[model samples]
Structures are given as structure tokens and as C-alpha cells.
Target chain A: MSGLQPCEILVVDDNPGDVRLIQESLKDGRVPNRIHAARDGEEALAFLRRQAPFESAPRPDLILLDLNMPKVGGLEVLRAIKASPEWKTIPTVILTTSMGNGDIKGCYEAQANAYLVKPTDLGTFSEMLSSIQSFWLTLATLPVG
Target chain B: MTQTPAPAISPITLHLLLGDLPGLATCLLGGGGQVLEWTEGAHALLGQGREEAVGRPIADLLRIPAESPLPLLGQRAETWSLLTRRDGSTFRAQLITLPVPEGHLLLMHPALGTPQPKEETVRELMELRQALDESAIVAITDAKGDITYANDRFCRISQYSREELLGKNHRIINSGYHPKAFFTNLWSSIARGHVWRGEIKNRAKDGSYYWVDTTIVPFLDASGRPWQYMSIRFEITERKRVEEALLEKQAELEERAAALARSNADLEQFAYVASHDLQEPLRMVSSFTELLAKRYKGRLDTDADEFIDFAMQGALRMQVMIQDLLAYARLSNTMEGTQRIHLEDALDAALANLSLAVKEAAPTIRRFPLPVVMGDLSHLTLLYQNLLANALKFRHPGRPLELTLGAEREGGHWRCSVKDNGIGFDPQYAERIFTIFQRLHSRAEYPGNGIGLAFCKKIVERHGGRIWVESTPNQGTTFLFTLPMDRSPS
Candidate 1:
């Protein structure tokens, strides 16, 4: 605990239930983390840019972006993040309900860190979130923020 | 009655009158039937000189039969008599005698039985010409292609009088619709003395267009060179108009069919997008209900627990049904990854996917050699997996499971079969089973969303094939499908 730093994670999704479930799943993970929720891609971009309401926000160490949402879509947000020199180092993983080959291929081609289909089973879903947290936050060497 | 003093008949005036009666033999005979004067026609018909023919007894020159005697003077008479020529040969003649003041005037027309008289032949020719002129648009052109004659029907159709058409070639009515090559070919054929037939579009005098079906016959002379050409034509403008209208309608129908196909494709795309989007909310419902059941199952009251359980089950089932609907829609939307693959490889992959069920069922499996086919490998794999899964799901509990997979070459395709000793359904439901969400058994008996067979049907059809099942209740089931053979050589 003394050596570890709190990991900041931004979750972009339209459904509040999914955000809450993801938060609950990662509550007891190996890495201590603070989760921020953005209801849409526009808000997610705004938060990443630290504009207005998010002026004092910390740069997220990782992002869990959903493919389908209101306003801008996850792919556009990913491209915007990757294109910006400041936010390009942030590891953005796509988490969505789609298992279509087109969506999978599109996310990878957009340089997503990882693409994961939202599992239907609650236990499997929680395990997936836990693994993502342990691997991206604790194990993988992400850029220092 | 002095007959107006009876103008003295001069020989020159009399000769001029007799010469005007061409193709007839005439002479003046005395009251005693003696030849008094003979015209050139008489000399020509009797093969004798006028000098010798005159002053001869008419009965000696003409062998007049006694039964058909000449009438009395001042009365005209006609009879068929035998005439003697200067050559001493006798021939039949139609003889007519007219009474005159001084003598009888005889007119003779040589008549041969098989060859008609000149007057009759001329009359028959006139009748034939009238019939042809009335029925057809007829025209005669000399070898130089200048119109020599135009019938009334031809003049009416061309809107030209005989004066305007004669000496004019067919170019006056040419519509310029046909290419130069068309006329060139026509002239070449007719010049060679061959009959030419074709449909021609001609322009009228009023600048209107007309179509004619024309046939041209060439008359060849002794040397086999065409001397003249006669063309017979029929008006076919109405038929050509009908044909053009039919062609236009056919083009319009083809355009409409293409538009319909485009609209149908758009609808299919919409269906795919709608079904795909439906799965998102369904996942939230299923995952949350499952989470609720997991987190607070024992902590809640029995009623609450039961309600949560029911919600969980309903959400889970709905999720699966939506996914199945998405897969069905996607089958039409995506048709990539087509390749030549071995059927045995596809079957082996399906067996590997069902490894757990296979181990549990412990079924005896038999496989025969399969042919290489053209298809999407993943789709074919899913097709086989679904069929085998159905067999395992509906296995008869009373007997050990036995399954067989085999294929046979059938013309341009391979007919493959999967036979299973299972709890077969009623034969009536054989067709219904391939429809989505159509189930014969309740969920308690067979746990399925009733999508496997439907998936198999879609996959089979996507590869340009057909799938059907044959089954008998309490007996066994056999599923047969056909796939087109690969066209590429090995």
C-alpha cells in the first residue's frame, strides 16, 4: 500500500447500470483505484481534456470505452485520444456488448489496447473486469501521470 | 331507200378500215360466196397473197360445214369453221359474216383448241392484272431500278399519283431508317436475279412513316440477266408500332424489378442493424438480474428470491433469443470468407466443438469419405455443429445413441446426410422444425431456444444448397443437405 499509487480509470458508457456494475466488480481488485464515469463519448472527451466541470480532474491511467453510446461514439473518442500527443499514452480498452467481426476488427484497427465483449454471465463479467484491472493497472507498465 | 345515195366506197378507204381491225382476217364476198376483196390480215391468216386470195370461192378457202350454214344476206352470222391455208393445211377459225350492200364481209380469227383466241387471252390478262392491282401494292421497275408502272394501291400508299411515281426509283419513299448496307445487300441480291424479301420503313408524302413487308421478284431474260423487277408489298406499320411498344414496356419492367431488388436489400440491412442494436439493452437486463440473484439471494425473503429468480431466467432467455435473431439477420448481411474446403475438416471441427456432449453421450459415431466443396468454412462448421447438437439433445433414452455422417455425389452437387437414432419428431413437423422459434417439445422436455435447425437451414441456403429432414416418431431422424461442388479444378 505504501509503494502503490491510486490508479485513475475513466469508464465511458451510456448505461449507468453498466458503470455501477463495473465499479462494483473492481472494488476489491489487487490495485487500489478510483473510478470516474462519463455517460457519453462527448462527456468522456471533455473529462479527458479537463474542461469546465472537470478542470481539476486527474489524467486517467486507463480507459474502458463502450462502442455504442449517445452523442459521439467510442471509436471517435478513441481516435481523438490517440491523435492528441497529451492523451496518446493512455491505454484505452474497448468494452462493449457487440461480438460482431466488424466491430472487433474496427476497434483493433483504431489502435485500441484491447477489445473485450461484455459477458452475459455476472460471474464471468466480474472476473473479466478483475483481470483487466490487475493486468492494466498493476502489472502492465503504463505511462506515469 | 337509196341509203343516202350510198357513198361510193373507195378501195383505199376500205383498205384503211380493214387494216385497223388487227389480228383478224377479213374479205368481201359476192352474193354467190365468191371472194371479192382480201385485206392484208386475210392474206396473213390464210398464208396466201392478197392477189391469189381474191376472186376465189370463199367455200373453197374456208371448209364451212353444211350443218352450220351462213345466214341470208343483210343478217349477220357467226360460226366455228375449218379454214384451208395456202400451205394445204386445215385449221379451226372463229368466222363472223356481216351483211353489206354489195356483198358479205367475213372476219376470221384462227382458233387452236389448246391456245386461246387473241381476244380471249387479252381479256383474261386484263382480269388478272385487275385482281393483282386491287389486292396488293404492286410496282414494276426496269433493270435500271426506275419505276415503269405503279398500280393504284401503290400510288395510294405512297401518297403519289402514277405520274409522280413512274420513272422514279424507290428512293423517293425511303425513310433513311435503314443503313446503306441494307440497300446494298438488297440491290446485290436482286441484281443477281435472286428474289429479295424484307420489311422496309418508308416515309409518306406527308412526312409520316410507314412499314411495309416487301417481296421483289426479278424477271430474267433469255441470257438469264434480270430484265425487270416486280415488288409486292403489304402494310405492316401497325405491327411494327406494337412491337416497339412491347419493347418499351419490357425495359420499364426490368427497371422496376431492379428498383425492387434495391429496396429489398435496404430492408434486409435495416433488419440486421435493428436486431444487432437490440442485444445491448438485453445484456444489461440479463447481467443485472443475475447479479441481483447472486448478491442478495439468501438475504432476501423467499418471495423476493423467487421473483428475482424468475426475472433472471426471463432476462437470460430473452438475451439468448435476441442473440439468435441477430445471428439470423447477420447471415444475409455478411457473406465473406468463401473458399474451397474439405467437408471432412468442417465435420471434424464440429465434432471438436461438441466434445463435451460427445463424451457425455458416448455415442457410436461413423463417418464416410466427403467431397471438397466451395463454402464459408465457419458457416459450414456451425451448420454441422447445430445438426449434431440437435441429435444429442433429442437422443432416445431407451436406446444407445448411434450417429452416421455420409455424403454422395449427385450431379453438380454433393448430397450429405446425418442419420441419428434419436427421439424423432412427427413427420408433419419436419418442415416446421426448420423455422425459428418453432418447437414441438416443451422446455421441460427439450431445453432449447428452437434456433439450431433454423441456423442450419440459413447456413445451408447461404451456400446455395437445400436442407430437409425425414423422421418418424419413436423411430429415428435423418437430416439431408446438398452443397454445390467446387468449380475450380484441383
Candidate 2:
């Protein structure tokens, strides 16, 4: 059942409610997948570097980041992720409330794969989540390990 | 020879007896010197019948003062005195006594108050006449309106000497501002016994114009018919000059206002042409790049593919900028027509249009009640689309996104704010970010051509408002802007 080792995704956020929502949205109404959440950017980076307890963690195939958090921010995470050749190949998509010109430009400039604004309405959120599954999980052809 | 009983006492007899008479007199004096006969007027003065008093003497009835002219009449041939009569009243009398055929003759004439006509009174009246001639603005014309005499003031005010004015007609000072018919009518009206009084503008001897308050009076002969006219005038040149200057300034201001209006219209037209002309070439460049990029993906090397992609993005950016510029130009030139735009509805439409990115980020947003603004639905739709997309796109990587939308009242209108926890920028570039084609981030940093914020700025400005941002790097951004409820106050 692990077709191509179900694409690994790293979700970074401090808010439990949003992390749960994103986890539920990404669980595959279309493609079956396992989801992991990091409460902050630092923990998310630790997971990506496979250090300590996360030494057995699989390399993430994609990252969904929140811009606001306690320890390190999403822009910093994007920068660190894109800087290291070990993790640079993994796609990073900015998933946050920010629609600022500087924020959008900053994340993409730090080499994020995509940028997305949060929809306030529920129906739209569900639709967007489903479409994300369709586009990234189905349409986008990533290099297979 | 009963001697006609001698006409009792005639004026000649009264004149002979009142020695106080100036020229002649006669008196009848008896032994006691009682005044006997007076002139016929002396009968009026003495009140004694001549027959009765003829035999009496003067001393029995009248008395003389200690220092008296009546006695002096004997020492000096004639005397003047205040004489006391029988009634005890005084009279200013000149007495002369001359013996007549009848008896000792005396003449008395009482003199009352009679002012002597002095020569200086006549001389002073003549001086007054000369003073009026000097002080008043005066001129005398003959029966035909020709100048017969002009005083010094008349010549000075008219800028003409007496030599030049004398014998010349009133037309010498004519300014010609009035119609010739005006003067002809004036003369004809006055010649028919009417006095003509009017203010006039007259040319001076040096060819400068002067105004005057003038009155011309006609003098009549003994036959009660007009024989001459006298005109008096005072100069009013300064007042006339002020009036002319005020008129000239008013005319100049009117001309300037008309010219300024024309230039403003020309500027509007130029804006229209410039933006419209740019759109055609922009479309060609963008479309050709996309064609090359699409058709040549595998054939191009890494650098070539990258170059082609950058070129296509640039062309596409140019196309969007041009479209926004054209829209901005039209917004200003066209008159504003508005429909109420529902905030939630427009916000929903914006999200619907932005579903692709929303899915990619999988963000969570919070919004409350919103305000409806007066705007064209199309522009408002685009405005919401751009703002929503921006909020979704600037999210943090590896984080769950949270966005908030809200509205508040500011400066007589509603301000919609989009607050996000995205990667924020420096606040110094807030004003510059709204300028056309002004971008804070490079194409490598952001996917947009930097036209979205500029478009939003234009929409807000056209609605008579302002837009700005507050941000710090790595922190969230709050985009605050206002839109007028209506173009004009409701």
C-alpha cells in the first residue's frame, strides 16, 4: 500500500486548531497520506535535518509553513530549507494568513515553491484543500526516489 | 387891499419861520420872544396857529438850554442844536434866523436819523464781486455759446490759458466721449429756456482727458430772455482713471480663467493616449514569449529555459502594468457612476477567483461583518481579488496560515484592512509600493509584476481616498486603506 512511500509532508504551525484542519484537509479524500505537524519552525527544521529523536524521520517531500510562530518564523524556515543542499530539493509552499507584498515576495525570494492566502470561509477552505491535493499530489510529477 | 387874508400860513410861510430848515426860514418874534409863525410844516412841528402866535414872542412859550444853539443863532448866522419845544421833547434842528418883511424871521427844521451814504460801502461791494470771480470756477459765454470771459480757475482746470480760451466756443474742452447729438440736444434744450446741468469728460489742452462736475446757468436780459451762459466746473480726473483700470483688470482675469480650463482638458486627453498606445505592443511581447516558452521546454537548456521564463514573466508584467494604467486613466477621465458593492459578496467572489492559491497554501482566515462601499462592481471585484490573493500568497513556508479581514470608520468613510501574519516588508517602502510599476521585491522573490498594489492604489484614489501599509521584516503586515462612501457627501 506504500506506493512510492506515500509523499512525506511537513506541516509547521503553533496553532493546534489550524494544524488539525490542515492535517484533515491533506489526509486524502483523493490520495491517501500520512501527516506530521510541527508546533514551530525550529521543530520543523529539526525534523527536516533528522537530528536526535527525529533521526529516523523520513526526508519530507513537501513543506506547508505558517508565517507566525513563537520560536522561528516561516520566512526563516524557508531560507534555511532552501540554503541546505540536503533539504533544498524538497518543495516548500507558504501557507499562512499573510498577503503582504513583502511577505509574498520574501518567501518566494527565499526559494519557496508556492505561496497561498488563507480563505476565511469554510467551503472555500475545503475546496482549496481538495484542489491542493489534486494539483500537488496528482498533477505535479516529482522525481521518484 | 384885504390881501386875500394871506393864505393863513403856506408852506412858504412855514419854510420862512423854521430857521432850523437847511436852506431858508423866517420867524415872527415879539417883545418877549414867543415863537410866532412856523412854516406850513412848522405848524406841524410847533402846533401853534400862526394868527394867534404872531403877536406873541418866542420866550413866553419856549425855553432855551444854558448852552444852546438857538441863542447861538444870533452870534453865528446859522446854528445846529437839540432844541427844547413847548412839549419838553428834543429835536435835532438847524436853526437860521433872517428878518423878513413881517418881523424877526426864524426857521427850524427837525432832523431825525438819516444815515449818510459812505463811499467805502460801495467800494467794499465791488471788492466782493472781484473775489467771487477769482474763487469760483466761472466762465461767461455770449448769446451764441462763445466764451466772452473766463476766470483764472476756469483756465487752470481746463488746461487752457485765457488767451487760448477767450472767444473760443465751449467745444474747445470737448472730450468727444459723448455723441455729437448729445451736445446738439443739450444746446437746443437750454436755448428753449431750460438750464442744462450734466457731468462731462473733457479733453485738456495737452490731450489728456479730465472729468468734471459742471453746471451752466443762463442769464436773462431785462426783457426776460436768455442772453448769456455761465459754466462752473470742478475736475474729477483721478476717479475716472481708477474706474478704467478696474475694468481692464477684470477683463484680464476672465481671459486667464478660460485658458486654464482648456489646458486641464488637454492634460486629460494626453493621459488617455499614452496608456492606450502602450497596450498593443505589450500584448505582442507577452504572447510571443509564452509561445516560445511553451513550445520549447525540453529543447532549451537549464539557462535557456530560465531566460525564456524570465522574459515571458517580464512581458506579462508589462502587459498587466499597461492594462492597469489604461484603467486608471479612464477612471479619472470618466464621470463616476456607482452601485453599492456588498463586502462579503465581493470578498467571496475574490476568494472564489483565488481558489487555486488558497488550495496550495491551505490557509485559515477569520473575518467579521464588512461594510458595503459605493463603487463600480467590476473594479471593486478586482480590488478584492488582488487583496485576497496577496494575503494568501505572502504566507510563511512550513506554517499554517491565518488571515484576518475587517473594516473600520476613518475620515467620514469605511476603511477595509487586510491583516496577515505573512513575511512583512519594511514600512519605508509603503508609499512607493503604490506608485505605478514600483515593486519592493524582485521577480525572483515574488510572482507578480508589482501591478496589484498599484491597481489597488489607483482604485482607492479614484474614489477619493488613500492607501498605505505598516510592516516590519519577518513580522505580519496590516494593509490599511480608505474608500469614500460616495464621490460626494451624501
Candidate 3:
């Protein structure tokens, strides 16, 4: 390990089981990373902006977003993130159960870094996370803000 | 009161008296009813002068018999007779015969109060009779509605001999399809000398039904009471049949359309509810089981690892199946989603969407110029993506994949085809392959829920086109579908 800082990943999902599954997958995978959680879109935005209770939250290197939530949806959060000059370059990956073309297109149009359909199988989900870890965190260069 | 008669005027003096009356034709007949003189009025009324009338037999000129009772009366007598004109046509005239010194002097004038001359009346009656015989089914009944005359046309249309119908009432052909009030209204109008016009359904002699457009006119007597009812009818059975058939077809079409709309609405709702509810639990099961496998793969036994893998694959496959079903159900809602789209643009979107697969297959795909079509752009994109992906997925083992995609105008639509040099199945399963979840090979060989072609078919059909396939085992497959041209040929 070339004395590099651990990668920070923020998982925003309304479903706690899905968030936990993702965290467990990341933990078991061979990746040096730290995982943060936001239960809904509102919390996701608050954490990203470091507002109120999240004032001391670290800026995430990557964001894994769920499309459906109680407040502002994944697309809206993506738009908000991309609209800000400071946060626009941060890679935001959409992880959604919706395989609809409109959802996929809308997420990309909002300037998401990538879109991934959440696999139903635990093994596939874990495999997808491992690939993401290797490709985005380990290999690919990212903007330092 | 008996009073003394005035002084008697001589017949010649009365002739002299009538000489000044305009349009009064006086012809003096000599012995044996022969013309003695033609007065000036006679020349004006008969178009014949004294030169033509004088010395001619008066009875012949007047179209009267010499044996008439008026000649035998031996005194002044007044009677009606037909007077011949120069044109050989006859007119009705009132003749007053006065016995004079040697013969009878007849004074002829226009018949009293008649609207038309006798010859014109005769011609009009004849024409009316001919018209009824050729075009109308006529029946004349006495004031009591008992049939007195049934013309040849009436007999033919009613399917009854004239002899059998001459004394029968109009009820003989009553079909009983109308209420009693219908006939009552008809009779009331005709009895009052007001013509009644309506349609009547009558039964023929062979028990078949016929329709007639009828007009019943009442002939009034001198006392202004109806003496006869003349009914003129025209057959309208064929026209009525066509109208009824058109109405029935319209009603059937409306009912079918309503049923289809209701079914479509129900399917949309079912798709929405099923997709939302079913995907939630499926996501959890699959995600967690996959996590279990990743976290404890080496720590668990081989059976445990295999069972976890099985559970994960089953849940994931079920999720795909549910998503496909949802897609099929959503097709019903896309009927109104149409626009003018370029086929090449849609294909481009599909190729871009399947970039990963296309890169992996490393296949040679040739695309030609495509025509513009009318349909939902997104749906068309999906259609092309699915078929292209299918071609890539089913590539023959140990052989390089090659694809040809192009479109050409066929009749009123563009017939587009995708030919692939991939593993082709038996032609017998061609129809089965398009059915939902019908797979030609094991899942291990090719991965699909067998809904792609069906989806393509639905999209094509929604745009008023059709889809078909041609293939041979171990060779290749070609999928052909059609999309209506932007505008039909003029």
C-alpha cells in the first residue's frame, strides 16, 4: 500500500438492508475504503453540504445513489451536485433497481459518473462492488477537491 | 206558385240573342240533326268556320248518336255531348236543342263548371294509370277499406293473385310488426281526405317479409266525403336491409373498442403494482445472499457455498423475469407515444446502448441507409437494442459473428431486417421462440427470458406493421420487421 489515504464512499438509500448489504460487501472486499451512510435524499444532501449535524463530515471520493427515496430523489441530488462548481467533478454513481430507460437517461443527463442496475443476487452485487472498487478507486484518477 | 208564362221567344230570336255572347258556339241543326248554320261563336270555339260546319251532320260533329232520347223528346232538351275540334280531339259541351219550323236548333257551349276539357282529362287519366303500372304498386279500395282494384304491380309485389285480393282488406298483408296505433293513424288521415305517407312492412305469400314506402290518397265524392282510398307503394326492402346491417356493424365495433380500452387500462395498473411490489423483496433476497457468498465463501462448506450460489442465481433470474413481464405489460400504454423518427437515429441509439456487447463480440455489423418512420423513438430504440443484443448473445461458438442491418420500402411500409451469422435453431421452433419465456436452448448456452422478439413484435404491430423470421439450423438467423412509412404513396 503506497501510503495513500483510504477511499471514502457515501451510500445514500432509503432501504437500510440495501445500504447494509453494500457496506458489508465493501468491507469483505479487498479494497482500502471507508463507507458512510445517508438514509434518505435529504440526509444525502445535508451530508454532502456538511450542514447542521454533518458539519464535520468528510467529503466523499465517490457517491452511490439510490433513485427512489422519501424526499428529493436520486436524480434531483445528482442535479444539485452537478450544479455546484465545487462538487461537479466528484464521481456520482447511480445504483438503482429501476431498469427503465427514462431513469437511466435522466441520471446521465444530470451528469452522473456512471449508472448501475442493482443486481438482485448477493454474489453479483458483491462482485459489482468489487469491480467498482478496483476500477474507480484503485486504478482511475479522480479530481482532488 | 203557378204564374202565367212570359211571351215565347223564337229559337232564331234566341240564336240572335246568343250571337253577342262571347265563346258561345251555336250550331243550328236542320231536319235529321244535320247542320243548317255555324254561328260566329262556333267558329271561335271549335276552330272551324261556317264553311267547314255548314251542311255537315251535326250529330257527327258533336260525337252524339242520332238515336239519342233528346231527338225523340220532340221539344226543347238540354244534354251533355262531346264536340269534336279541328284537331280531332273532343271536348265536353252542353247542347240545348230547340224544335223550330223544320228541324232542331242545337246550341253548344263549354260544359258547366268543369276545370279541364274532356280530352285533356282523358289523357291525364291514361298517363296516371301507365305510371302506376310501371313503377308503383297501386290498390284502390272503397270508402270502407275493402279492396276494389289491385293493379298488376300490386299483385306482383304482394305475391297474391288479383282475384284473391280484390275483395280483401289491407289487413291481408299486415306483418303485425307495427303497433295498432300505427294503422289507426294512417286510416284517420286518409278517411279525412288527407293523404297519409309512411313505410309499411308486409308479409308475402311465401312468408317472407317486404317493406314498402306507401302513400294513401282519398278520393272525395261530390258531397266532400271520401269515396275511395288509392294506395301507391314502392318496394324498399333492400334499402332497409342495408341500413339495418350498417347499424349492427357499427354497434359491434363500438362494443369491441370499449372492451379493448378497459383491458388495456387494467393491464397498465397491474404492471405498475406488480413491478413496484415484486422488485422490493427480490432485491433484498438477491443482494443479501450475494453478500453472504462474498463474506464467507472460504469459511463455509462446499455445499453451503453451492447452495448460496444457487439461491443467488434463482433470485436474480426471478428478478429479470419479473422485469420482463413488466415490460410486456407496459406495451399497452405506449400506443399513444408516437412521433416522426428516423430509423437510422434509433439504430444508432441502440448501438450506443449495446456498446459493451458490441465491443466484446468484435463483430462486423454493416448498416445501410434507413427511411424515416412514425413511432415512439424510445420504443424503437429498445426494439433495435434488444434484437442487436440478441444477435450478439447467440453468436456461434468458435466462429466470428457478422451482422447485416438494413431497411427497404416494401409496399406501404419499410421492411427492415437484421441478418446475423450466429447459431440458428430449427425452423420448427420459429413461432415458439417469439412466445414469452419460450427458450430454444438451455439457459447455460444462451441467457434470455425469450421476450425480446415478442417485444419487437408488439412494437411493430403497434405501429401497424408485422414481424417475421427466417432461419436454418447451424447456419444463421434473420429477423425481419416492418414500420409504416411516414406517408403512404400518393
**Which model scores highest in lDDT?**
1
What does candidate 3's lDDT look like per residue over B78-145, in tens digits?
87665668877666677787777646777777765453356768889889899877889999998888
Best by DockQ: 1
List candidate 2 stretches off by more than 4 Å. A1-145, B1-272, B275-317, B328-336, B485-490
True-vs-predicted CA distance for residue B240, candidate 3, Å: 3.6
lDDT of 1 by residue, B1-490 (tens): 4555654885446644985586788888888888888888887777777777678777866666564565545678887666667755566677788777767888788764324336566678779889988888999998988998899988888898899998898789999999999999999999999999999999988888999999999988646889789999999999999999999999999999899879967866776777667766777787788878878998989999999989988888887787777777777666676689999999999999999999999999999998899998888999999999999989999999999999999989999999999989889988999989999999998899999998899889879899999998888999999999999977
Model 3 clash pairs are A120-B286, A121-B286, A122-B286, A122-B290, A123-B290
lDDT of 3 by residue, A72-107 (tens): 888989999999998888789999988789999998
TM-score of chain B of 2: 0.42
lDDT-wise, the better of 1 and 3 is: 1
Model 2 lDDT per residue over A55-126, tens place? 888887777888978889888998998999788877788887665689999888898888987553334555
Tens-digit lDDT track of model 2 for B127-156: 875786766677889778889899888888
Give model 2's docking category: incorrect
Q: RMSD of candidate 1 to the true fold? A: 12.8
DockQ of 2: 0.01
Q: Decide which is better by TM-score, 2 or 3.
A: 3
